[model samples]
Target: MAYWLMKSEPYEYSWSQLVADGRNVWTGVRNYQAANNLRAMQVGDRAFFYHSNEGREIVGVMEIAKTAYPDPTDETARFVAVEVTPLMAAVTPVTLAAVKADPRLVDFSLVRQSRLSVAPVRDGEWAMLCEMAGISA
Candidate 1:
């Protein structure tokens, strides 16, 4: 399965909130590239729940419960969204600093395209990140 990293602002939608909600539509992606990434997602694919802006860390894991669909939050219908559910919280939150320092993750999309809200994660990078987060890949 393909892997991904999806960012969410803590104030807007925190990892704790996702756990509490159980599952929710991942929406509000206005960037074409990010929307395309969302469209690429498939049901059962796993994503790292990166808490951007505030925490700047990957706090948990989530599974794509539903594939891409028309985003109800969008007025023009140009964007799409997927449904994600909490899989498990990281035992050790992986910070941006930690990620940047890791030589193995030098080419990771999260490092290369820092502003991208949704980004693809390579298989090797995914495994390394899971290791850093103290979780099984």
Candidate 2:
């Protein structure tokens, strides 16, 4: 399955919130690139739940429960969103500082496109990150 990373500000929607809600509609993306990434996602795909802005760390795993669809919250109707369900929390959070310090992830999209809210994760990078986060790859 494809892998991806989805970021949410902890104050707005933390990992705890996702866990509490059980499922979430991932919407409100304004960036064309991030929007496209959401559109590319499919049901069953795994994603890293990242707490951006504040913690800047990946704290959990999630599964895409629904494929891309028009975001109802978007009046312009140009963007898309997916439904996600919490999978499991990372045994250990993978901090942004740690990612930056890892030579293997130097070329990772998270490093290259720090502004992206939704980004694709390569196979090798996903495996390494899962390892770092203490999750099964």
Task: Pick out the ten consecutive residues of candidate 1 with the lowest summed lDDT.
Answer: 102-111
lDDT of 2 by residue, 1-137 (tens): 99999999999889999999999999899899999999999899999999999999999999999999999999999999899999999999999999999999999989999999999999999999999999998
lDDT of 1 at 101: 98
Query: Top lDDT: which candidate number?
Result: 1
Give candidate 2 misplaced runs (Cα > 4 Å): none
> Which residue pairs come into collision in candidate 2?
none
Q: What TM-score would each prediction reach against the true structure?
A: 0.99, 0.98
Candidate 2, 88: how far from true, in Å? Answer: 0.8
* Candidate 1 local lDDT, 29-136, one digit each (tens): 999999999999999999999999998999999999999999999999999999999999999999999999999899999999999999999999999999999999
What's model 2's overall lDDT?
0.96
Give all candidates' CA lDDT scores: 0.96, 0.96
TM-score of 2: 0.98
